[model samples]
Structures are given as C-alpha cells and as structure tokens.
Target chain A: MAATTLRSVTTYDLKLAAPLALGFLVFFVTPLVILLALSFQADPQGSRYGLTQYVHFLADRFSLGVLGSTLWLGVKVTALTLLLGYPVAWLHQRAPGWGKGVIMLLVLLPLLTSVVVRTFAWVVILGRQGIINAALGGLGLIDAPLKLLYTDSGVVMALAQVQMPLMVLPLITALSRIDPNLADASSVLGAGHWRTFRKVTLPLSLPGIIAGCLLTYAAAITAFITQSLIGGGQMLFMPMYIYQQASTLQNWPFAAAISIIFLAAVLVVVSVFTVLGRLSRGYTNA
Target chain B: MLLTRRNLMQTALTLGAMHAFPGLTWAQARPLVFATFTGSWEEAHKAVLVPAFRKATGNADMVLDPMLSVDQIAKVTAAKNNPPIDVMLHDPGPALQAVAQGLVEPYPVEKSAYYKDLIPAAQEPTGPAPFFQVVGLTYNPETVKTPPTSWADLWKPEFKGRVGITNLNSTLGTGFMVELAKMHGGSESNIDPAFKAIEALRPSLAAVAANPGQLATLFQQGQIDISPGNFNAIQILKARGVPVEFVAPKEGAIAFKTTIHIVKNSPNKELAFKLIEAALSPEVQATLMEEPYLIVPTNTKVAMKGEIAKALAKDHAEIASKFVFQDWAKINEQRAAWIERFNREIRV
Candidate 1:
C-alpha cells in the first residue's frame, strides 16, 4: 500500500509538469534539432548535405580567432564581475536589515533599464567628448581624451557592469544561505579576518560563486547589443560574426555551423563550471 | 447548468486553441501586412503612405510591419505558400536577392498608372524603386571649418583620427567602398583598390561604426568629425540640432534605389498592388519629399523642393547628371567575399 501511494505521488508530480515538458519538446528541442540538421548542409541552397560547413569554420584561422576572443571576453567579464560583485554581496550580508534594501535596489537598478539603453549610456560615457573625458580635461590631467570606447577593455568593463546583477543576485542567495556563526567560530579560533574569509567564508560561498560566474559568463558572451555597441564594428566577436554571416551575407549554412561550434564551446565551458560547482558543494558540506 | 469535468475540459481546450492561434478565430481574411524598413522609413510610411493607401482602398485593413530587408526576405522565404507579409521594402542588394530567390512578384506594368511616370532608373519590372537613398559626406560644421568638396578630403592628414566608416555589412558601407574603388581606377567588378584606400585611411578612422545608425551617435559624441552618411539619416540628425552638414562630393553621391515589391504568394495581392500604387503616386511621393521626411522621390512628376532639392538634386535632370548608381547585380556576386575580406583586413 505504501509503495503504491509513493509511486502514484511521483507519477502525479511528473504529470503536473506535462505542459512545460511538451512546450520544451515542441518549441525548444525541435528548433535545436532543425538547427543541427541545417548546420550540416553543404551550401545555403541545401542541395547537398555534408561536413563542408564545419570544415570551412574549423580550417579557417580567422574564424577560430573570433571564437577564442569571445571565450576570452567571457572570462574577463566573469573575473571582473566576481571581483567587484563579491564585496557588494558581503556588504549586503553584513548590512543592518533596513540598509540591505538600498544596496539591493542600487544593484538591481541597472537591470531595470533596457540593455540597449544601458549600452548607449556607456557609449556616451566612453566617447571622446564624454563625461570622463570632460572631467579629465577640466582637471588638466591629459591633453587629449583617452581612447576608451571600441576597445577590448572597454567592452569587458561595459559587459561587467551590464551583467553585474546576474552575478550579485546568485551570490546574495548563496551568502544568505551560509550561517554567520562560521565566521565567528574562525575568529575565536585566532584566524584573522582575511584568513577567516579565505578558510571559512570563501569555501562556504563556493556554490554561489560558481553559480554567479556561470550566469555572468554566459550572459556576457551572448550579449550581442553591448558587444557590438561597445566593441564597435572592427572588434568582430562571435555573436557579431554570426550576425554578419547570417543576416548580411545570408550564408545560413556557415552561420549555422559557426553557431553549433559556439554552442559546443559554450557547453564545454559551462560543464567545467558545473564540475567546479559540484566539487564546491561537496567541499561546503564536508 | 451543472459544470461537468468533460464540458469544462472542452471549453478550456477551445479557448486555449483560439488564444494560441488567433488565425483560427480570424479565419483567412487577415490584414495586408507590408514589411517596410524600420526607423525613419517606418515613421515616414506611418505618417504619409499608410493614410494614402487607406484612402485609395476605401479604408482597407492593412498593417505596416517594419523590419530590415534581410528579415523581410527571411520571413517570406520561411512561409512561401502563405507569407506573413504582403509587401516588402528592400535596398539594392536584398532587392536583387529577393528577385533571384523568386520571392517577389513582377509588378503589373500594364495595370500600374504611375509606373510609366517614374524616372527610368526607378522603373523595375520585378520591384519598382519608389525612392532613392543617397549616400554623401557628412561632417560636423563646428569642427571642420571648410566644407569637404570631395571624397579625397576624408583621407587628408587634417582629418586624422576624425573619420568614420562602417564595415561592408550595410548598403551604405558597400556603396562607399565601391565608390572609393572607382575613385582609384577600380569598378563594380574589382574592389582591390578600395581595400588599399581603406588601409591608407586607417590612421584617420575614429570609429568603424557597426552600422550607419551608429555613425550618427559617434557624431553626437564628437567621436568622429566626418563619415560617409546617408542623406535622410543626416537630415534627421540635423533636425535634432546635431550641428551636422551633408555635402555631395565632386566624385558624385552614391545612390541606392529603394525598391518596393509585392511578395509572391500573398493572400491580399489586390490590396498589395493598391499600396504600391499609393507609394508611387506623385502626391504621396511629393509629401514624403517635404521637410523632416526629406525622402528622395523617384516619381518624375513630383517636383523637388525644400531640403531634398537643396541638399540633393534641384531637378530630375540634375539628379540624373549627379547621382552615381552602381551595378548592384555585379556587386551582389562578390559581396560575400568582400565582407569576408573586410572582416579580416579592416580593424581599428
């Protein structure tokens, strides 16, 4: 009787998920399958199906360079966000109950606006005669405006700011889950603040760190608007590269092949993060 | 009425189906969807063309679904039998692509009252050109004291770190490159000189804008003093008090025929014809040629005035003499290669 009830409950739970499961199958999985098939076609006309598109992308040095730069850009943005986002998360944890709301609102403010609007603001801020240049110019610190916009570092900075909430929100959740007594226990045992953080707090927040990094990394790389607007035309990241090929050139086979390769590369990166997250979970519990 | 589970389920399912596919409720007689270009084009059409179209068809149910030419082609190609859009607007490149793909219906020349009245260049059998998108040199009047007279001024040492150009992804960018090639003894078939010229202009380039739209922003920010800009786009900026000026170079301003087409297999073919007819009519074209819109009218009967006449050509004969139209068919053949080379070579 117990076994039957248990089986019925499990089946009922799954049945409840039927609509969403069907939605995924019809909308998400089906298109992905079609995209996969489209990637194998030899030409835009799809007269012959073969490995030609993949070969073209893999053989070309420029294509590979674009892929590498995109991945590297994700890495830079993730690292920057983590470095910057950690303190805010820590502050939120330590903030007196009422103070937490203000910090949270400030962090969430950027996310409230459209990414296009945020990116254009960055464009204005980074331009030759922008606020930063004007400030620097007024101070008589420089003869000319710094070439801040349309460069690699500029893109990374803009993306980090744009994707900050993705990193911070996950981190806040993780940090809140951690007990405060652990830090106190470390301090009473004669560990310094830095040492306590490294040994106790850091290890405990590993899950949050990993989750935040994964979310931020994914968003930063796929941020087509921010990437193009900040990086400009000459930068040529993977998203823009795909857009140019697919939309402008109308070479769908090559575009699809590139997209598949990008997906695979992203999967590899994400898997590595997941493995770290799994290990961190084990470490935290132990 | 006692609500049984069976009847409740039946009602819910029916409602869900209706919500999911509104077409199921509306049946086959949907509005005529015309996919015009986004931004200023959409604004112009919404203000002028749509009203004209409505007046012609006695308040026909129509919609202006604005998007890029490439997007328009993609949507039509995706659903060839029952296309979502009835009409499409295109630049020179995508216009040829649409014709080659057999996505455009040949204009009913015998039926079109205004087709014969259009300038010779605007009269296309597959899709007639309703407007001309002119590309010329745009600069900030405050910074650049002397008005640039030729394309060569962009390459001058005086403009170092003050020039802007887009990559070959846009019609404006590709047309600019072809014109550069021509300046250096190359033509539509060969683009080598253009690459060499860009390489020479590398030092002067302040920003390689991702699109023509970005160039306007760069100008507002003072990131670039000058760029190869569209006439209509610059006019929009100037109206916004951006302190920018447009000039037709001695080499000639690059003109792209902005063609409108009837999508093949359209359900509302009759309405689509009426819309195109309204677009080509002198009255509609003349209104579009006025201030703010400043759209270059291709109808010979629509006398040029205001910004269009002052900035572009004064009359039809002057337009013929001044405007340099390229062989887009030839350009389209090697466009992919040019874009690839551009992606590889041009980096700021």
Candidate 2:
C-alpha cells in the first residue's frame, strides 16, 4: 500500500503551481469579481444596485440584435476559416519534407504580421477601387464597383483570413498524427480517396477541427480591432457595443452587464464545443 | 565582504521592495505627466510646446503621455487622491465631462499671464482653450472639380456612392450631427432633423468610416470623394500628397475648443499651470498654427496666418463670424441616447 502510494516521477506537487494560481487569483479572478459587482449597479453613477442594467440590455431589441449578429458573425467566420483552412492542413500533411516546411511557413505567415496590419490590408483589398474591383474593371466584367469594404461578406472574408492560422495549425497537428498505413489499409479494402477521407482521415481530425473552430469562433467575436476596422462603424458588434457604452457614453454598469452577457454566451458556445471534443476523442479512440 | 547567503537574500529583498514601492526613495519626484492626444497632436506638442514649457519652467522634467481624452479621465478618476497625470487635454465634450466628474482643477485666471489675451470663447474658469479644431468640408480636389461650399451638398445626387461619414462615437461625428440638425431646423436638444438628413444621404454614402483617421485612408484609396473632415487631419493628409483640400462650408465651419487643465489632485500643480501658461502663449500658438501642425490658435495675440488664415479665417473677428461653436454642454446631456439611436438606425 505504501509502495503504491509513493509519488510517481511523472506527477508534480500541487505546490509547484501555487505562484501561478495566486497570480491568477489576484489579477484575473479579483478583477472579474469586481466587474460582476459593478454590473449590478443601476446607473453609471452607481446610485443604486439592482438588475436594472441587465434588464435594460436583455429587454432591448437593439441590444439583443447586436449580440445575435456578433455571434452569427463568429459562426460565419469560423465556418469560412474551417472550409478554407482544412484543405491547406490536408495539403501540408501530404507534402514532402521540404514542402512541409514551405507550407508551414506560409500557414504561419499571417500570424507574424499584427492583426491591425492584416485588417488594414483587407481594407485596401476590399475597397471600391481596390485590387478585386480593379482586376474586374480591367477585365471589363462590370461598369460599377461592388460595395465590399463595409459589407457583412467583407467582414467575414477579412476575419477568416486574419484567423486562418488558428484553424490550420491545429488541423495540421491532428492530420499529421494520423497513421499513413491506415489510409493505405482503407484503400486496400477497396475504398476511394474521398471515401477514405470521409471515413478514416476526417473522423480522426475531428478533435483538431473542434479545437480550431473554438479558437477561431472566440477570436472572431472578441477581435475589437479587426471587427471595428473592417466591419466599419455602421456595423455594431458586441465589442464595439461594449466600447460605445463604456468609453463613449461612460455607462460603466451597462458596459459591464453587456460584457458579462457576452461572456456567458461565449461560454455556452465553448461548452458545446467541449462536449463535441469529448465525443470526438471517444470516436477517434474507438 | 564574505558575501554570505543570508546577506545576499537581505540585499535582494531590499532591492525588490525599492523597485516595487518607488516612494521609498524620497530624493526623486515623479515626472510631471501631461496626457495629450496621440498622432500629430503629440508631434506638434513635443516639438513646440514641450520645448517652450521647459524653457519657461527652467528645464523642468515633464513627460508627454499621449492618449485619448476618455482614457485620461479614466486614469485620473481611478486614482483621484493621487492622480498619475499632472495635466490633461480634452475636446469640448470630454472637457465638460471631466469638470462634471470633478477630475480637473479650475484655471487660476488671476495668476495666468496670458489668460486675458485669449479670445472670449477660449476663456473658461475650469480650463482654458489653447487651440480650436475646425471642422469643414474636405474633398478630393482631383475628383471634385467644384469645391463643396455647403454641408447640404453631401446629399446631392451627383455625389452618389462617393461620400463618407463616421458614426457618432467621435467628437467630429457628434459635432457634424449637431450641425446637420441645426441646418435642418433642429437644435442640440432636437437631433431628429439630423437623422432625417442622414437618411437622405444614404443614397450618396459610400463608406461610413470607423473614425476620422479612417476617412484619410478612404480618401487615399479613392473610396470617398467628399466628407465633413477636421482641418488639421485634412492638412496632414494633403501634406502627405493626398489629393484632399479643406474648405469652410457656406453655413459655417464647426469649431471645437481643445482645452488644457491641471488634474485635481496633481502633485505637480505649479508645473502644470506653467505648462498651460506656455501653451496659451502667443509664441507657442503661432508656431503650432504654422505648416505641418496647422492647429487653429485660440490666442488672439497670435494673429492667424499662413494656411490657417487662408483656409479657415483671416483674423480673430473673421473667426468669430465664420466659425460656429456648438453648445457641447447641451450635446453631452443626450449624447448617450443619440448614440443608441444612431446604432439602431444608421446603416448603409
């Protein structure tokens, strides 16, 4: 019993993580608790404490619409990133050793540049007389420029590009971990490339897909700079909405309430992904 | 001399404590931090104002911590007892907000050497306006053959899909809305006409930029031909070889007074007053009004010249006649509701 109870070499003492835990408590948890308390105030002046701010947000159609649209934007961006990122991940996995390095560098290239720079590049690309419109106009495809810069499609496209690295890297890790012999074995049993991919390769990469989607989804929603820059002022997301309330209006209680609501909404989505990840783990093991 | 482990530990802790709590060292006073706006404002102040301030104060140690007006208010409000900023710069809207929040000290009018030399509009007991930000019609000279003379020209069919404006989160945006409302028979309390005017401008709108800064980029990209833009911002863009020109609309140029104040509980209050005094000086104001900066001066003694005289107004009397200063106190009262309404309504 003593032999069995002896500490294993692989296990670390809980005391080793005490400093980090203490830091998290002081910085992160303490601030969050304060924010939660602040949100209960009825007014910016904190004259009364109640659920007025929450009610004010939840009851308002405009506020709910902003929240809905922000969440929907995340869904659209995550979907686009996954759709575009999956092929690159697959290609990376299938590449030769040197080709793998080249593909990795290309995948990681966007991450090196700042998000603001990337967003601005998107602005230049999506403008009325921008590269796309210029190319189209030169080819005599259209007489007038298409409105792309401030549109929903413009925001989705930009966000997808900015967050592409998050989706692709995780996918590459998952795809590389799959056994090369399994695909060969599936083919030997008379399955086609698409069939083998759907059955064997696809299921194996589900965990990575879930993780990538989670990261991209969360990032695309809270990305204040990219959302504001590419999405334009007219397009109000949760981040901008919070900023408007907090900074512009100085309604701290309302801003805090909105942020807490946004946080709760994000957590709900993350939990759904977490459950899927657990199921994917079981499926991959089986 | 032995360098014992116990002695080494004591030395390390002493150093750490001194680093953490800097007040333990009583020999040094903290640098007098002046929170100014970023970009060209910082550049202009660093080049002209800082040098002038140092010269006046016998080479006093000061730092220019550039940030937005709201951020300055927040930092000062967070530590009211011991404010980090000795001085703060604010637009008309935030200047009132700061005063209401009791974040700033009232200007010592009796003590100031140059306060009486300023224009009547520049004199405020809370904080004195050292500079004016003029908002006028900014258009691409290359694209716009005939320069826009009125704000109403934005709604004209000829400018279809060639105009840009910002949402009402910025001073420029809010001021523009107030101007529009006034043009359409509405006052500061009544913003309904402005919303109606903006509705009419929907057909002509190309991009509603996130901020005034984005408007410059939009002009560069040829995404927008015309918009109501700040004079200084337009000058900066034009200096960078962008085909943009500033013109005072026939109605009037919107003037926003950028006020400077000492933080309420500032330890460097004396130095802060000295710096503000330097800002209000004709020498500093005149230099700032010159090329590259193009910042409008509030000091009547400065005598507006060069680009400011050419583009904005000829003299202080002309400035009074041509520039329309809005009631920011009234605007600030219902700005929150207006912002909410704009969020709900404005979309192109």
- Best-fitting candidate, measured by DockQ? 2
Across B54-155, the per-residue lDDT of candidate 2 in tens digits comes to 999888889999999999988988899999999999999999999999999999999999999999999999999999999999999999998889999898
Assess each prediction's global lDDT (C-alpha) against the native: 0.94, 0.94
Question: Residue B54's C-alpha lDDT in candidate 1?
Answer: 90
lDDT of 1 by residue, A173-211 (tens): 999998899888999999999999999989989999999
Per-structure clash totals for the candidates: 0, 0
Best by lDDT: 1
lDDT of 1 at B339: 94
DockQ per candidate: 0.83, 0.84
- Looking at candidate 1 chain A, the ten consecutive residues that score lowest on lDDT are A4-13
Off by over 4 Å in 1: A1-12, B1-28
User: What RMSD does model 2 have?
Assistant: 2.4
Q: How well is candidate 1 docked (DockQ)?
A: 0.83
